[model samples]
Target: MVATAETGVRRAAGTVPRPLRGTGIGWLFVTPFVVVFAVFWAGPLLVGLGMSFTDMRSTDVRNPLGVELVGLRNYLRLFDDELMRRAAVNTLVFVVTTLPLTIGLGLAAAVALNSGIARLPAAFFRLGYYLPYVTSIIGIAVAWRFLLDPEAGPVNQLLAAVGVDGPSWLADETLALPVIIVMTAWRSFGFDMIILLAALQGIPKELYEAAEVDGAGRWARFRWVTVPMLRPALLFCTVYSSIGFTQFMEEPLVMTRGGPAGATTSASLAIYNQFGSGNFGYAGAAATVLFTVIAALAFLQFRLGRSR
Candidate 1:
């Protein structure tokens, strides 16, 4: 029955209809993604983890002695092997060499982009920076190989024009790792720059205004306001770069093939060599070790970030 306003009475309040949310259609829509992730990501990760525990060679199921559990023997090999030690050293060198350039130059570019700079310069500069990243890795490697050739290369030719002889960029063991590091930095920093560009945009206008009111000079304002604000983003980028360094494979594979007397061989690339040569057990073990290192580094960074 309808209730009059004067009565201030109504039939018992009807149950509020529960809003229908997240229908089966939602799961149906995400099913493709779920399927792909399980197949490509989860499956391989599980397989790799299992492989890490076993002496699973490509040749057989690694059941030569009926049960092939090598325990930590394979993991121990990386520390004991001279070549693996060299690779680890080379990888560290690459990381240490490239980090400043990538982070510094990336932040600088981001700042420039944030500034109301001339549009044309900004566009072209961004393109020039990012082009190397999207371009084929092999193309970069091949171009660098020729450019750094001991003779008959434009880079050396320019040096000769200036009455200076360029050192063989990737030919000398002393120079090879450094060259790879530089090239990788060049190819990579653009992505970091764009990430930082977004982070710079996210900084509130009020922060700068507040700094200005405090009579903070540009550098001081940057140090106090901008840098402190950007720390979280910077930390994330650093961690990402560090992981990439751990997985350094392409530079040595194409440019040096872990050559120049193994100066540029990284743990990842060495593991790849093992897989290619049918030593999957060794590869798996090396991968497991590298994985542990990466996981630890990642956890450390996250802890540091949380503390910050």
Candidate 2:
């Protein structure tokens, strides 16, 4: 009976499956990424955090072991720093103005292109809009500087043709920041437009047809159907543009250098100026504060997105 049972079991188990491999192999594949992240990203972050609590300066490079911990002194100084205050206000203004404009223009462009009004290939229009985003920032800044030149720029020249004198865009403190905001918005809207376009494409045509059959007009359908469907994309673009605007540096640095009485200075530019002046501790403190603000904003955006 035992022998018969054993033979029956062998017959039932014909072509036995191999045992599944363990997760050890998967860990091995991910080990390199983990190692690199720890060494580069995690390590630097920890060091920077430590540096923020101390009076670490560029001169300390000669005596790396002799740094003194001042315990919040750097952070306290930030409150009294007039330049930092100006930078913070400038950054806030940039965020308030640029975020809406970027998202609005992007959505408008996406809608127009998706509507097929240009009578050109969609790819051509898409590429044309996206070109500035891919181009180098320095190159764009240089071109814009020329275009915004009060005396020789084509923009001012065009204004002259119409007998409207263009302001000294980069020279006047009052207009400089606004000009930078506009330039930044133009360069950034392309990315948001592309993302929104993809989201728009993913929406089913039946939804629009259903709305039309239900007596929904163009604006009504857009408000009821389109906006709701595009909420996730819009949320992403808003949060992304918000963060970028808050941390604005390169444009102001290259274009204005925080000039015209530092009207265009941003938090990043302030940090850069501090770092350049060998006030490493102060810079790190400012950086940590900026990081906190960005993190808080991101958290709020996430909560809002989830709530909606």
For all candidates in order, the CA lDDT equals: 0.81, 0.90
Q: Give one digit per residue, the lDDT tens place, for model 2 in 1-308.
A: 22335689898679656438876876889999999999998887787788899999999978968899999999999999999999999999999999999899899999988885655677888888888989888999899999999998999999999999899989899998999999888998999999999999899999999999999999999999999999888988987789888999999999989988999999999999999999888899999999999989987887777776
State the displacement of the C-alpha of residue 73, model 2, in Å, after optimal TM-score superposition: 1.1
Worst 10 residues of 2 by lDDT: 1-10
Model 1, range 1-308, lDDT digits (tens) per residue?
A: 01122234332224434348746866888999999999998888777766666677776754444437777777787689998888888777777778877888889888987888888998888889888889889999989998888787899999999999899888788888888888888898898898888788899999999989989999998899989988867887888888887788987899989987778889898889889887776788788778888889887877777676
Candidate 2's TM-score reads 0.90
Q: Candidate 2 — which residues are off by over 4 angstroms?
A: 1-20, 116-120
lDDT measured at residue 116 in model 1 versus the true structure, 0 to 100: 83
Q: What lDDT does candidate 2 reach at residue 1?
A: 22
TM-score of each: 0.86, 0.90
